[model samples]
Target chain A: MKNLVLASTSTLHGQEYLEYLLPLIKSHFRDCSKILFIPYARPGGISHEDYTATAGKAFEKAGLQVHGIHEFDSPHEAVKQADGFFTGGGNTFLLVQQLYRNDLLPALKEAINKGVAYLGTSAGTNIAGLSMKTTNDMPIVYPPSFNTLGIVPFNINPHYLDPDPASTHKGETRETRIREFHSHNPQPVVGLREGSWLEVKGKNIKLKGDLTARIFEAGKEAFEVEPETLLNDLN
Target chain B: MKNLVLASTSTLHGQEYLEYLLPLIKSHFRDCSKILFIPYARPGGISHEDYTATAGKAFEKAGLQVHGIHEFDSPHEAVKQADGFFTGGGNTFLLVQQLYRNDLLPALKEAINKGVAYLGTSAGTNIAGLSMKTTNDMPIVYPPSFNTLGIVPFNINPHYLDPDPASTHKGETRETRIREFHSHNPQPVVGLREGSWLEVKGKNIKLKGDLTARIFEAGKEAFEVEPETLLNDLN
Candidate 1:
């Protein structure tokens, strides 16, 4: 069965990287001895090797060995052979650009569909949905397309935040941005807040974590979904 | 001479639409009686007519007539005939998409280069730079390209925000986002804080308003420039 853990962020406030998701990671990839890391996202513009090592240290705590896809002679071959995968978050534009340049998206999608364990955080989580249009990241680079894995029927707005009642910043709020997305896209969107994640087992998709997620469907008012709510057929 | 006012935002905190810029607007377009408005950004998904009306109401206070480009039978013709222009803030992706869809970019650039007075706020201001790569707006839609007018030598980060010392949000800060853009793009970026603007006269560009603007040059530490500082040769 297909299995995945798509999280809003790799770290919560005042927490170590992937610290909150370690327990879930250990259980999700229990069957796999090795996990391949896609470090194209490169948070803070860190080197691919450095990003991979960060992921490796975290996965090691769960008794799993991790290798970066960049280390392989062929990224496509790396995706095909890996039993588990993790894509760290950074600039979605850069991540998408690198993935397209390497022609690794197809193999990665196929591997996930074939039941290889997968974990995505932030930009990584944003790509698991219908499109990357709902992402909050800046357009640091131009990708060939906005299409992604579409492992889920809907899109994801990771690092989703509620509007501050006191502040007066003029930038579009997260909710406004998602509604703007609906102006051009028909896909539904899930606003996943920090410390929350989606757990997918086969065709079943459930909200995992204690917080409630905001849901945006075209032509309908945005509403909240409680934890453990099934979201596989959100559309 | 070429004249333009590119502001970080049209509205300031607790201020009416364009309230903070009325005097500047009056002096900037003193030579023209009518202004052609580009309402493609459509803040909050407002209709072009309504957004144009909003601009009209604001510009009327300065004794200037305003009409939306959408109201014209040919947006291209509208750009060519208008002596002054204003592109309101909205989603940059949507604005760029509509401009490209109507094949209006070249004409618009030509008109501006010919010294037609122009005003841009937020997303509109972002397009006056080398590219739309530094905008903070969500990618609600995919544009054909990230390229913009190149009326200026650098990119503008409109409504530029400082990182909140108290907030725990994990989303990339404005500075981090711009640095990431530098990773792929070579253009310098100006972080125009709220209420600050750039005044372009012929070949000269100067920072205006009470606040200092942050300047980011690739491979160098970001620094702040005082108000009224010359910005035309930032690179």
Candidate 2:
């Protein structure tokens, strides 16, 4: 059985870091006494130690002891030993690069597949997908590869925003960028807006939260799926 | 005598494609009679031929003959013989991938350095910079390298937008992403607004158009440079 909570964002507008997801996280990691935190995706260029402390502070409310992988002698060993894991949000390119550099992606993937409880937000959630191609993050660093954990059958576009009909910005919209991805890649993409997430248990994946997510299948029109919709068939 | 007009966008909102930059482009390519168009960065999943025709239509008004690199028997030969070049906007990853795949990057760079008239918009303009690290496009495809032409010393964030203070969106703003880039990369980044561009003549580079471009230097605060300001010293 696989247990995972992949969210679009760690913090919502006007909310504290991971505050809105605390209730769900408490129940999700209920069985684990310690949670290993992967702080490679340093949001706002935060240091690993500082980022880990932030996560530790948030998880304290759930009575979960948190340790950052960076603090360990071996990140690969840390992944194998942890009962639960949490990866925070930042630049997806940097996160992916660091994961490859430390050579912990395989161990992390295997741990998640072995049913270790896992939590991912934004850049973290983007890596849970088949590839990081649909990530909205800038390519600040060149990663060795775009391939990810493949825990999810499809790719995820985190912090997805709908095009503002009244706006005049000429940059490619979230919708347009995903469409471009489908042009060269065959994977379906889920546009997970802020405050929404995918809850995966075993082989069952359900869309969680109140808002509907935008679904994009290659060569097909983008459609919306409501919360609680099973997304296992997307692969 | 490098003649180049690297624009932020090919089209402005409510304007025809490449409409806003026509006057500048015409003067930029005035000495050339033929223009070779590279349409590998196909916007909206448009076919290569269709994208080429679109460029042809726009350049026809300037009384210059237009032909896509794809139409030539040998793209390398076409580049060597062309007096002017136009690389239109689309996906930066795809454009770079194709440039490497066709082994045309070296040839294109050589031609540009030899004083061939060159015009780039969006993804095209992105490649004119040192690297595509600051590009806002999705990673639709994996390119051989993030390295680019480096015709200009700094990286470019085309269609650069300012943070909307009133918006509640949780997505990382353009400024945050660039700041993140600085943490990993040392290159300075120019945030070129839609109507702004960098006009490079020989070793002299100047910000053009009506808007003041945002400049981000590594380990320093981002600042603004007015139009006609020389940017040659940024490197």
Candidate 3:
């Protein structure tokens, strides 16, 4: 059975890293002693060692050892053999680019599909989708393709923020950007609010967290799905 | 000599479309009776005809005729023969992709470098840079390439926003995002605020408008440049 946790953001406002999701993460990786962390996204351009250490500290609280995947000679082999996969949040373009560069997409996909527990936060959650077209990150780097691991059927819009009606900025709102994504791609997109996560246990993908998720599909008005709703049936 | 107006946005808060910059736009295109409008950016998903009509109305205020580039059989030929070019703002990726598809990048670049009056707002302004990698727009569409006009030596981050000091959003700030961009790309980037525009008169590109512009270099600290400052000297 496929086992995965895709979270919108790693930290909520005023919360520590992985603080809110720690309990769920501890339970999700209960059986594993170690989790491989992919730090290629490099949030704020942090080093892989530093980013991995950050993950290491959080996972230590959960009593699990964390290792940076970049330390291994063969990232592909590491994914194939690891007991778990933990891709942190940062730039999705850079993450996808490295995954392709190291030829780790297929191996990671196969590993997760074959039951290796997977945890993705922010950029990590984005790669679990069919494509990274709905990401809110800047195009700081150009990836080889917008495609990602289709571990889940639909796409994800992570760190999903609703339009600030009070905002006077002329930049397109998050809703407008997602709407434009539908203009080019018909795939369903889930705007997972901060603190939201999708718990994929085999075919049952339930929306976790206290807040509701906004779902948008081509040709249909966007609607909100409740916290406990299952998202497996979404097209 | 390059004669181009690269604006941060088409409209400012509480103002009509191109209202604040209409005077400069009219005078820039003083020798032209008609301007070819590029609407592939499609702000808010407006159609080419509709977006062009919006531009037509604004230009009509300046006693000039307007034509949508899509109306012409050969968009390339249209750019080559046009007295002026106007690329509206929307999605930078979509604009770059359409330019490549219609093979209009070269023509537009050549015409602008040849001293034809050019006006670009938002996405249009983004394409005036060395590459689209610094764009603040969402990656709603994957363009064939991130390369752009390079009419100006540096990249442009249009609609440059200062982080809200009072907000609690944990997502990376605009400054943080641009720093990450420098981590990957060493090119210089200019942050064009909402009310700012870059006036490219021959070899000198000066920052225009009432607001100051932010200048970001690959390794140096980001600093502010006052209005009327010549940007050609920036690295």
DockQ of each: 0.85, 0.89, 0.79
TM-score for chain B in model 3 = 0.98
Q: What's the ranking of the predictions by lDDT, best on top? A: 2, 1, 3
Question: Can you tell me which runs of candidate 3 are displaced by over 4 Å?
Answer: none
What C-alpha lDDT, on a 0 to 100 scale, does residue A70 get in candidate 1? Answer: 90
Candidate 3 CAPRI category: medium
By TM-score, how accurate is candidate 3? Answer: 0.99
Better of 1 and 3 by lDDT: 1
Model 2, B13-52: lDDT tens digits are 9998988887887788888876899999999889999999
Q: Extract clashing residue pairs from model 2.
A: none
Model 2: CA > 4 A from native = none
lDDT of each candidate versus the true structure: 0.92, 0.93, 0.91
What would the DockQ be for model 1? Answer: 0.85
Docking quality of model 2: it rates as high
Across A96-150, the per-residue lDDT of candidate 2 in tens digits comes to 9999999989999999999999999999999999999999989999999999999
After TM-score superposition, the amount by which residue A187's alpha carbon in candidate 2 deviates from its true location, in angstroms, is 1.4
Candidate 1 lDDT by residue in tens digits, B83-197: 8999999899999999999998999999999999999999999999989999988898889999999999999999999989998999888888988888788989999999999
Question: How do all the candidates rank in terms of DockQ, highest first?
Answer: 2, 1, 3
